[model samples]
Target: MINLYPVLKPFLMAVEPEAAHRAALGLLKSGLAPRYRHDDAALRCEVFGHVFANPLGLAAGFDKDAEVIAPMLRMGFGFVEAGTVTPLAQEGNPAPRLFRDVKNKSIINRLGFPGRGLEYFVAQVSDFRVAQGAGAAADGMLGINIGINKETASAFEDYSRCLSALAPMADYIVVNVSSPNTPGLRDLQSENMLDALLAGLMAVLNSLDIPPVARPVLLLKVAPDLTSDQRAAVAQLALRHHIGGLVVSNTTVARPEMLAPHLREEAGGLSGALLKDHACAVLGDFYRLTDGRLPLIGVGGISSAEDAWQRIRAGASLVQVYTGLIYEGPALVPDILRGLTARVRAAGMAHISEAVGADIDLAAPRAEAAA
Candidate 1:
């Protein structure tokens, strides 16, 4: 498919960020979005028991309500994650919540987890599956990212509710505990609270009537601002609970020095090119702390092939993109896949999985100590 984002760039930039996002989604839902298909055997890898066509995936925020999964999959991503959907719909934060620093290729959004809630989200997914026939997700995997409502007194209730409602249709379920825009959401990452949260969620999963083979794997999304100690605690808790995987390093609260001064003070998590280094650093930390035992999905500031390769070598079995799509558009998926295919051949590796953690030595004293 031809890349039309270049022509659309000027117009998209002229509109407000949130408006531009809605326009983009409307285009996708209406089948106006361009589609690209590039599937290379070298790019295939197994993650969380499912074999993904490639390591690159669309991160959760883009399809916040599961509206456009099929269109995105047709655009060449190996997988697409939908929703940070809550049990109940929310309007999210006030307007002006999404801000763009075009110069730095970054965005700051405090748009909490706004969506049509679980019932609406589940209905959309079910319709997608039915339309695709029995082989839904055959082209690419589907992940559902679940989150809590703004006023929920009990986090477990919200999370478990979402899990029960969405897990049946998801290839995997991501428990999002790291969105900075949601009030007190980050606090759940604390060791004590996280321990309890994971335990309760696991219990709920075990109680589900789905057969063992069909049950979706559970993953946790964490913040990028974790201290070394906090990272260690999370790693241990994940191992203890037998969690399926971790979406390493969500958007950062810390603004890079290179970010535009005015954009720096925006009250939200920051993502884009400026976030690449720190997100990779956090991915490396989690890899070492977990001793590379857990699968990690690297995301944040990935707009090119080299960025994806760096995350793979740094210990991410898979990587995802959100902000990168805003800057690079539909062609980004094929571009990265082609680059990765080349990189894998140049490195003399048969498949992309061989390059995972190529940059880290799990036997190092620090890693051993962390473990």
Candidate 2:
């Protein structure tokens, strides 16, 4: 094994950004094909009501159709989440919709929510995971990230329909109220809107109520653009209605300090190192406000193990990455898991949860209170 990544970077990054991503995913799928991913790294941890080999995972949008999910899991993620799949398949915004910021190690994507419809993705994904068995990569937790159509008024219904269909085959379900590309989707984060959306969706989930064995988790993903007040409101609301928990802070619409380039004019969400602070702030607010009452899954500009640690301490029980995987490639997985273990040891904690919120509000007594 030759890591041709160094040789491939300049040429790949030199091309159109979205093309580069397609190329990279093609390579990852072929190089670490589904059948060969079992032994890359044994990085497991327990989260989302199941056991994960490690806290590292590929975020939604990476495997839009769920075609390569098994390979992503095999590639060494403690787990993997796929899709923002709608009731109908859409082509997404338009090509040239994804861009790379070489200097910041970031990616700007307005790809919209392109993917095959819920039924198609669910059929394939269900059969795929069930094929994994009692002890296999498929045995590791599998989360289905669901969203509504870009042009649908039935937003709430769409989420339920998808969840009801996919939940049977899923280990967890994420209610994606945050992707910046979708119009009014982020609005669902408002307390009133979120309450109804979750209430309706939960009604559907409740109808499917299978007792004894664990039901697929229902997670709410929020935007990074939310104000401090909104962050607290989200946690409070989740607790109020008992939404499965929260996936704090999705790709941000805000741009941090940047390179002097025309790409700055590109519309869409920016993710990667630039997103770290806003995400941490949101997570910290949620931690302090919720007192870690609601389980949190962190997603924002995560590019390294240290970043994972930051989110964990800020109150995330687990973390997900998308942009970092684009810039750094699949090798980034094991690197993050190894780094997480090292950081966990440095903090003198036996389990990762002990480190959750370890640094956030540390001076406030409660942050250090968890540790």
Candidate 3:
């Protein structure tokens, strides 16, 4: 029997990018899958106060809104992060916003933080609450990716607004200041900028009658293009403010040498194969810097079981993927979980946490040195 997906993707890619995304969401919501579920086994674990069935999670920018939660949950990822939702729902950048360099198995996208606003998303969370028994909610980690608006003058207010709305609804909330697509967004990673943003947001989080960090984790996502000093600064900030967790990367603005012709000219952050080494390198560095004091959501260029395990071993207690799914489809989720379990067994570890930072030498904390 001919597999329908291979025949469909080419044609799908031929259509407008945003429209095809809608169609994919519809298929998932309608309970369609490219293959049958091979693993219904629960792979639960506790992390950041919530119980995650598996370390696998859908990365941000995949479901910029919670439009396909029920369907994505049915596919078996332990968690799904919806949105990078902003304060306002706006159409993203102009067309050709998404591109596939199939030869390199990489994708470049400038889908500027497009989202349906926090108010709309809170409603989404309520209407589509994943049963704590059979969904990302039940598994212990349903994240709402938080971000600022592309045109907003006060990015801090944008983040604060989203946090206030999502704190009660989300299992954990991620503060995204790392997407390269939004001009000046990644600049938030600067020490002064990050300090200001997190300080403002933290005030709001503390005031929440039910803060997300009341076992509600605040995760920070970042761009991969940071220098060693910048990475150290982020670690210091994360430690200083008690950031509950982190997503190691958003996407890369740097186009590596392996990129094919015209690949570099495209405007957007790059993900997939090209990002593998750099992403891992940064994770390793962060692991060394933090000394295992923080929880991290590893992301970028993970397309295989080995890739996921590498992040786990590097210090990420959890992992997320976006581009890999675009290229490989739904089957990728289970493959990651099964691979991770096998890797754990091979390492002769009884629990996944034992495998974290196994090879990375976590040096002393940066704060101690500064003091």
Candidate 4:
């Protein structure tokens, strides 16, 4: 597909980031966005019991309300995770919350969980599944990422409500306790808090009327800012709770020294090229902590297939992108897929899964020392 982003980037850059996002969503929903499809035996893989067309996904913030899953899937993402959807509709932070660092190819967003609420989100997803008839699985997997409202009295109440409503429609459900924009949300990542939260959420998952085999896989989206102790604690808690996977990670609040000084001061999570190294380091931490027992979806800088490949070797079963899209456009999806296919062949692997964690040795003395 011809990339129009180069032509459109100037115009999009002139508009407010959030407004441009909304317009892009509107265009996608109207079927005006370019569509690209990629299917390669070498790039296919299964994670959390579902087979994906590829290992590349569009990360959560891009389609915050499940508005364009089909369109995004058509654009060649192996999967599309929608929302950081709250239990109630929220206006999010305020204007000027999303800022661009063009030179660094990064973004800073304090747009805390702004969405149309669970009811509207569920309806859109349900309609998408219905429209796909019996062939929904062929279109690509759908992951619904749910989060609590800003003023939620109980995170469990808000989370369980979203889980109950969206699980039936989701191939996997991401409990997002890591968005820095939401006050007190990151606190949920604390060991005690996360343990209790996971216990409560697992109870809710078990109680659901859905059959165990058909139940949506439960995953957690975490931040990249955890202390070493916090990371170890999280890994232990996740393993103990039998959570299906972890998205490592959400955006980071820690500003990189390389970021433009003005953009670095933005009060929000940072993502994109500036975040690449730290996110990968955090991802490697989780992989070692979990000992590759849990599937990890790596996000936070992946604009190229090389980035995705590095993530896989570092133990990401799948990789995702959002801020990268702002710079590269939809053509990035196919480009990454083609590159991955080549990498798999170069590595003499028949399938992408063979390369997952190829660089990690759980038995290494260093890993044991760290443990």
Candidate 5:
């Protein structure tokens, strides 16, 4: 394990962010990406009815079309969430939609879930499933992240269609209604809309010919910017609907004063280092609001072991990373896991779960009183 990113970052970063992303994925798909090994068992986590070898996962945007899943898993991720796959193929936002704030180690992108249509997506995962059964990386948990097509008038229809076709192959399914890139997408996160969307998707799952035990776990990806009322309401809805878990956040639309002016001007969701505090605060809020009843997968701003440990203590059962990889490279995963193990041992916890929400006082002050 040589950390190749330092040597590669200059060339990679010099290219347009989006192209560099594609190139990185291509390298990964071609088995040319660097690999790291982690034998630590302390970081194992059980969430959403599946056991993850570790809490770290590759977030959805990195492999939007389900490519490089095995490569990613082999690289030592406990799991890989694939797609914000829509009902139809989409071009997403125009070129230059992705921007890097090297100074702040953040990214702003309005990539509106551009992906090959569900049919193609299914074909790819179907191949993966088949290969998995035939001695591929069976230990790797695969989650399918579903979303509505940009032009779809009925969000429910698009979600239902995606679930009906892809759920059987997914260990869990994420209904992504929080992306800010698509117009009106965040509207679905509203209490009424979110409930309807989730309920409809669940009904579709239930109606399937498969046994109840066979249905994939359903999770929701929410915005980081939700108000307190919204957080509580969504938490209630998630519990009411028996949603399996929540991906604590998508990216943020708000630009902090810390961002460089040029990067701040970009119009899209912001992710990376800048998102750490905001993402953890939201995770802590949801953990408290849900009363620790619901499992949470924390995403955003986690670039190191300490960051992952903080989120775990803040109440995320598992954590994910995307932009951090853009900055820190694959070695980040091993480093995080090592750090988590150290933290767990230092905290006198045998398992990482014992650390979940261990520091409620340290969590961001509640949006309303009483954190």
Candidate 6:
């Protein structure tokens, strides 16, 4: 399709970042977002018992309240993850929470979880599903990401309640314990807390009224900031609880030295090109830690197909992007998939999955020089 992001970037950049975000969503919901259909065989892949048209997805935070999911899917993402929704609606931090670092092609956001909450989110998805019919659901998957309210009395209980309330509408339920904007939220990633959280969520899944055939897949979204021991602990806990998958990372609290001086100091999660290496390393670590048995959806940098392919080779079964969309526009999806198809062909593989982790060692870290 025509690339409009470049022509629109100057205008988009002039607006406040958060307002620009909402404006873009407005365009999407208004039936004005770019749309393209890609039926290339090489891009098709499957995981978590579902067939994905491609392995690339629109990560959480971009469509936080389930708005524009169908429009986003039509833009060619294999799936779209919506929300970091809490039990009740929250305004999140204050204004000037989302900042863009144009030079570094990154974003630092302390927007917290400014969303309409579970009741509205679930209703929107339920209504959208019915309006679109089977064609929409068959077109792409919708992954619902849930988190706790900033002031909730019990984080674990909020997660269970949200999952229980939204399971029927969710293709998958993501337990978000790693967003740094929520105070003490990242602390939920601690071994004991995460173990208890996942166990409780699994129990919620078992207790859901939905039939087994309609049960949503369970996945964990984690932060890139973790020590080796912590990563191993989280991986083990995930396997122990039979979690369906893991979104290899959220965004990092660590600021890269190279980020522009003005943008580096923002007190929120850092994402985009600045995040590429660290996110891949974390994905590789989890891949090796789990021996590639656990499916991972890598997110963080991923601005191009090379980035996506590298993460897959490092061990991500699927990948997601958000900041890349801001920088590269709607054309990014088809571009990456096209390049990925070429890479798969060059590697002499019939399918993209065949190349996953092919260049990495399970016992050691792959050096930067190796790639």
State the lDDT at 11 in candidate 1.
Answer: 96
Q: Worst 10-residue stretch by lDDT in candidate 4?
A: 362-371
Q: Per-residue CA lDDT of candidate 3, range 1-371, in tens? A: 12466767887678776787878888776756543233423345678888777878888877777877766666777788999899898888878688888888898888897778877888887777645545443333579988878788788888888888888778888998888878888888999989988887877888889834454678899888998789989999988988887888888999899987787788789899899888987887787777788888888899999999888887888888888887777768777877777877788777787877886765654444321
lDDT ranking of the models: 1, 4, 6, 5, 3, 2
Task: Give TM per candidate.
Answer: 0.97, 0.91, 0.91, 0.97, 0.96, 0.96
Error of 4 at 153 (Å): 1.3
Q: Show where candidate 5 strays beyond 4 Å.
A: 361-371
lDDT of 5 by residue, 1-371 (tens): 76888889899999998889888988988888667667766777788777789889999989999988888887888999999899999899888899889999999999899998898999989888888889965468999999988898788888889999998899999999889988898998898988888788888888888766667899999999998888989999999999999998899998999998977678899999998899998998888888788989999999999899899888899999999988998888788878888888998889998888776653445654332
Candidate 6: worst-modelled 10 consecutive residues by lDDT = 362-371
lDDT of 5 at 134: 91
Candidate 6 regions with alpha-carbon error over 4 angstroms: 134-138, 363-371
Native-referenced Cα lDDT, model 5:
0.87
Residues 288-321 of candidate 1: C-alpha lDDT, one tens digit per residue: 8888899999998999999999999999999999
lDDT of 3 at 202: 77
Provide the global lDDT of candidate 2 against the true structure.
0.77
Q: Each model's C-alpha lDDT?
A: 0.90, 0.77, 0.79, 0.89, 0.87, 0.88
Task: Give the better candidate number (1 or 4) by lDDT.
Answer: 1
Q: Runs in model 3 with CA error above 4 Å? A: 1-7, 14-16, 34-43, 130-140, 211-215, 363-371
Off by over 4 Å in 1: 134-138, 367-371
Extract clashing residue pairs from model 5: 305-336, 313-357
How much is the lDDT of residue 62 in candidate 5? 90
Q: Model 2, range 1-371, lDDT digits (tens) per residue?
A: 23566678788878887777678778766744322132322235566668776777788888878877766777667678888789899888978798777778777889999888887897778667666863443445688899989889788878978988887787788899999898888898898998888788878887895652657878888887887667767778788777667887788887666732766788998888788777877777777778767777888888988888888888888889988876776667767877877776777777777887776663475334321
